[model samples]
Target: MGADSGFDMVPRLSQGNQDRREWERFLEGVKQYYADDEQVEVGPRVIQFKAGEWPSLPMEGHKFLRFSSKITGATAAKTGVENYIREVQELAKAVFGGRIRPWNELFDVWGFYRWDFVHATMKLHNLVGTPLESPAVWLVLPSRKDIATPEPIPLTSVNNQGNTDLYEVMAIPGRGKGLVAKVDIPKGTQIICEKPLFTLRSSAPPSMHHLVAEKLKLLPNDKQREFLSLHNNFPGQYAFAGIMRTNALPCGPGSSVGGIYSTICLINHSCIPNAHNNWNEEAQHETIHATRNILAGEEILISYANEPSQARQRKLRESFGFQCSCELCSQPLQAIQASDKRRADIEQLDETIGNPVAMMSSPQKSLAACHDLIHVLDQEYGGTVIALLARLYYDAFQICVAHGDQARASVFAERSYMSRVECEGEDSPVTQKVKGLMRDPTKHPSFSAYSTRWRSTRTARPRNVDANSFDKWLWKLSG
Candidate 1:
């Protein structure tokens, strides 16, 4: 059968691909600005500006002379937000050689100008700010009309799943500001869904300081105070960068974009975190969900690394200018040693399970290795490892379907869907695909790849089997 044999239930564009397409569209939209006489870099440009210095126009003309007074260091600092808009208007003329037009006027233009990138693309609006010495260009992706946008649970809706009122911000000892549950939060409950205060490019230029400063200035006075209140480990000249480094969260699958959130950034780090953070592309927000039941008064924590041992986690924490004394890090020396060994074994099993040669020659052994890795992760990290668990279960589901074990594939696919819904949102493409597989495992692309060996109906659960016995049977565990 062909790869497209299934009902095509899954969304075609992955988050990574969507981002790339948006960037390409942005490049195409801005291509007209590049002069035929002068060679300009094709992609995003990183230009550096000195403190209180305005960006030099890429396209120069006599029209720029009018803005000379406003662009100077002494006058730029004295200008208020109102004057800043006029400055941007003048700068836009200079940058585009009077060819710059409103976004609606630009026929192919799509995407909102994120506040942080307003300085780079001088489209004047209420949220606009002055240009930085080295303005960083940000390409915002146009919203996909084909995919249904997932609505987040309203903050005030009491009956909604994962109500926002369940948690509160408080000062915890040792850890500065941390989120705490006011009441018990069950697994998969959404804790927070907040749009970022600003989204910055990871490869930002040195003039990012000025860009950040300009963005902050554009905020209301109250928001400006709130932003300044966040933790800043880097205390010297570039205070803005310091605060950003301490609080920025990854915005997507790739590291190209980093976002700052006032509330989510307050959640502290733990080697064994009870909560997990996810970037919801559909909602365009950073979401936090309880990976396990979190008791009242318990501090919310999320892991900072993928698979950092205790020692490595400690080292990673030092960059935040503090040492972690979480449950995992506070264990006895012998316990820590045992935990490290378990983590090492989990890594080894992961590698073995992914080996193509092992899968072809010893499929059973490969499946068993995945089971072992899941067990180790559960024992060590508990529900905090739900993301990894979801991936592993999906792998097992694929293996079972490929070898024609519809019964096992159905169970694994159900598990994968539940775990993915808990980790990613229920609307996620992975979760939706797994849901379809649970309904009809034979529809999987790899279902006919190998001859039927352990074929059975999708509903082949043993009657009267206890929960423990069912799990053992599902995993093919020996007595």
Candidate 2:
């Protein structure tokens, strides 16, 4: 092997050669190894390059050898390649569905892309992985230097001939001019629907006066006034800043910055909300749906809690300087006190129910304890019971399958899959694994002694039972 051969094996990692002395040393080593390459020691073993195999190298000191060659010129991994294909499919669907079909015309006429780059990036991230908690992601897009800026979308307003129930703005105490109900709002009702008045995605913060002023300049005179009238704590400042502080609903990922809505901002806050603010990309609409029956003259409310709970509800309301007086909060003191006691009981029971020691001698007692906690939670929250049930069922499924109780394990597996699908969506890998168990419970290698306690033919109610007796039975069965 020549000195040139030594230079070819440069110590530099990737790209092209640049340094001179390092390159020279690499040339010397390459030449020496080339001359007697079969005996060139790399730790405990010699490398025979011609055979393209390295002898098993022993661990140095206590360090384990983990070596994998970096593939040259590879920009993405196999998962990345699969993701690209998935993205292409989504784009194809969007185009065929007409969401992207007018992109050329839309961009040419408006001078800016329909969807900003930041939101696009966020959507891509969500497509790949599921975060343990919240699903929203934040993205910032570059502002355009060219093209005339579009006018701000207007807040929905009253029309004389038609009932302006959807458009009428009401003054909410603490929070300013919130939209109020002129009529009864039914469950799943879409109260307000309007485009974003104007959106700013950049990190740069401007004074409220400046932001509102800029938005006003883009809109017609009447719409401008409506936008200005929206609830904002800081009235002296620009309408934009004030509205943001008062009425902005979080539309972005992970609840970072609050987003302003032209019409939806008027909806009030409730611990137990009748209405839910939701986004529909297909319709290009931000909608409010009633979760339960809302009466005439009652204020439509949306829960500010990312997760529905009394504690989180209070925190959100306090942050905005208002005490929520929703129906739940307006309930009798005794009822509220009972609810708090139940919550505390559940909290305490949580630790003991899952403890292995508690079940050491009597598995029945352990499952019984878990059942009691779950029943209490279920009474307080309807479908929320499914989330805890899913987890408990999965644990029991593993135990049942381990003990070769295929029928019992299969029942738990089905329950696990159903709950997972309802909470996390059917597409999630968590749901997929549970679905696999549903298919073949006993086939799982985990099926053995661990499942013995949960295995029972009487999975449901036993004989004639009263409400309290039935509850007791549930506890004992689960234990």
Candidate 3:
């Protein structure tokens, strides 16, 4: 679970004294990098990569840096084919993380300084302005002429980073950029699953711009550009700090460590969002699920972290540099007050339910509070927040299992398992663990932790009981 203290493996870009030629300094650095290699091909532009397809297509060359390769070389001829072009596409992906960009260029522009990939052609123009800004390996690629390329696909929402068929990441007039649903997305559908572009440890220093730069420096040329393209609210401060503060999500619950995702960061915030995001520990990636039926063209928004309007406003403004006029925040004054009261009640119940003293001294009272909390939540959110519901049911399950009440525990655990599946999916470790508990409540680690006074078999849950009778039996309510 522990990460490196810092990015110590990535090399620092060093400055030279006014004693040697800049070109000589560059060559010396390149030699030092390849010193350990057995074969040193000090030759022309080499497009070296394992090609996937047969029947190579004619590739004249691609322009990189300031060089234009006109004469054909041995290395260039070896790699100047259709398959090598695919390798370039794969390489360009390191920069922007999109498998298929709108321009439809497939160029290996990752390590290149100022490399451009457009229309199946490669050119170096913007980004890192100077070669010194890039690592020593950036100077190693062979020079080649850009040949006439095929037409590229136009820019559209369909050209998203991942299998984002249901939604599109694009420019929003007021919000800078946001994800909008391309289709009517059903509730509980998994929209996105992505690994972090950059995951900073909890031990990061107060001023982490330098470390951010170092991390970017170590990555391929294209990846750096992709990450830097994300919105940065603080113009006056370090870009990484601003972007990280603005877009990074936590690695997990209570994990101070934050991760920046290529597509996830494009999702704008709302106090009452239509989508819910979660980090799965077993998968080592993040996922976003539609909390409700999201209509086509509607912006797919996620709660930065839903809280009281006052807290939400302060955090959004301070951290994200935007005043939230979300549905919950924009509600009329009376309704807003009512909603806040409901939220406050939910928080209070959650705190009390989590208290050991409240569970021990007044177990039945805590169960009643749990029941009341669910009803209040039904009024406020109408079960759209399945993760919250999952947790609430999980708490009730533990309470039953702790007191050795397997029948109610089985029922409660089943609810938790179902709710968890709606959000985290059945494959999720948390969901699977809940499944185990539902099948056999005694398997819960906290089973019989408090007392076994209410012991019963899991089959004690009545099969043919009426709904009204089942409710009384489940909560132990005397009729």
Best candidate (score: TM-score): 3
Candidate 3 backbone clash number: 8
> Candidate 1's residue-wise lDDT over 263-367, tens digit each?
787777777888777777667788888899999989878877545465566556555767667798798988888888988887798778655445545668878
lDDT tens digits by residue: candidate 2, 59-160: 121111111111112322322322322332243232122111111121222111112332243244332211112222312111110111111111212211
TM-score-wise, the better of 2 and 3 is: 3
Clash number for candidate 1: 5
Residue pairs in steric clash, candidate 3?
45-142, 88-107, 88-108, 94-223, 95-222, 95-223, 105-120, 110-221
C-alpha lDDT of residue 477 in model 1: 77
**Cα lDDT computed for each candidate against the true fold:** 0.59, 0.44, 0.59
What TM-score fits each model?
0.63, 0.41, 0.65
Question: CA RMSD for every model?
Answer: 16.6, 20.0, 22.2
Give the better candidate number (2 or 3) by lDDT: 3
Ranking by TM-score: 3, 1, 2
